[model samples]
Target: MSMQITLRRARPSDAEAFERMMNRPEVHAGLMQLPYTTADFWRARLAEPGGPAVAELHLVAEVGGEMAGSAGEDPVGPAVRRRHAMMLGISVAPEWQRRGVGSALMAALCEYADRWLGVLRLELTVYVDNAPAIALYRKYGFEHEGTHRAYALRDGVYVDAHAMARLHPNPPRPSPG
Candidate 1:
């Protein structure tokens, strides 16, 4: 039998469950101290600087009505210069890893970018040791832009991350008849 999964935009109310999903050991190990992030951290990230918050679009994959996985696109900035790009993050629940949930969320995000955001490209950074994630990014057409050596200190040790980007394929223009 197959797992029943559904994808939808994430909301502030889903905060607690999302935090729980992030606590799995494989997730904590692979992501490097991720489970250490407090629930308040996620709350702040999902919101803005004021008492209210900045609005951002994030997606979650729900399996059997539980928060199973998540993916999000964080716009670089409102500066006209930076509007063309957005950063991405993805996490699949431990039980759902290697299943179709991650791929489905990725596909849906790409579609949203193409149809709604007029996005010229999508980008992300993946740590060098996370082979599965690197494979997934490559499979979805993201190319390695470069490696930021010693980019982050994970568990007191530095870890490098590879920057990647996927540009929207341009459609051919019509020739003068």
Candidate 2:
């Protein structure tokens, strides 16, 4: 493994860099449901209205000691019954793709999901044509639930997404030592 890259909670300082990655054209093409968002909108989103949830975490991967990637989760719905579930979002800088960053973030999200919130399921949607991200989701044990046809319009045309979820096994406890 690449030990030089460190993964941790996204601090306020890392917000701008993370937003930059989110705004990248390839990232927008592969990951988003719409066009690039304004910096202010992204900043507010990263600020987290209340704060980080143990389960609803925002993480960044620092490589060579610089912010290189990010991942996050948020309540999937406003309804009380759906609070136990969260949505997943992950991104690694173009230069950092296929490195350990995405895996590290997924591991952290799973840990937080099971142990912190006692969540039963965690899910995400990836563009139907995004093969690499789909592979990554599968590696993390997310099963494809189904695909939504033309769920999003990209470049004035429709695109689809595959919804996937992982129902975790029992969460591991931290070592007492």
Q: What's model 2's lDDT at 157?
A: 84
lDDT tens readout by residue for model 1, 29-70: 666345566677677765644221222468889989988789
RMSD of each: 3.8, 3.5
| Cα lDDT tens digits for candidate 2, 86-163 | 899988877888877888888888888887777778999998888888898898899999999998888788898899
Q: C-alpha displacement of 17 in model 1, angstroms? A: 0.8
Using lDDT as the measure, which candidate wins? Answer: 2
* C-alpha TM-score for every candidate: 0.85, 0.86
Cα misplacement distance, residue 24 of candidate 2 (Å):
1.5
The C-alpha stretches of model 2 lying farther than 4 A from their native spots are: 1-3, 33-38, 52-55, 171-177
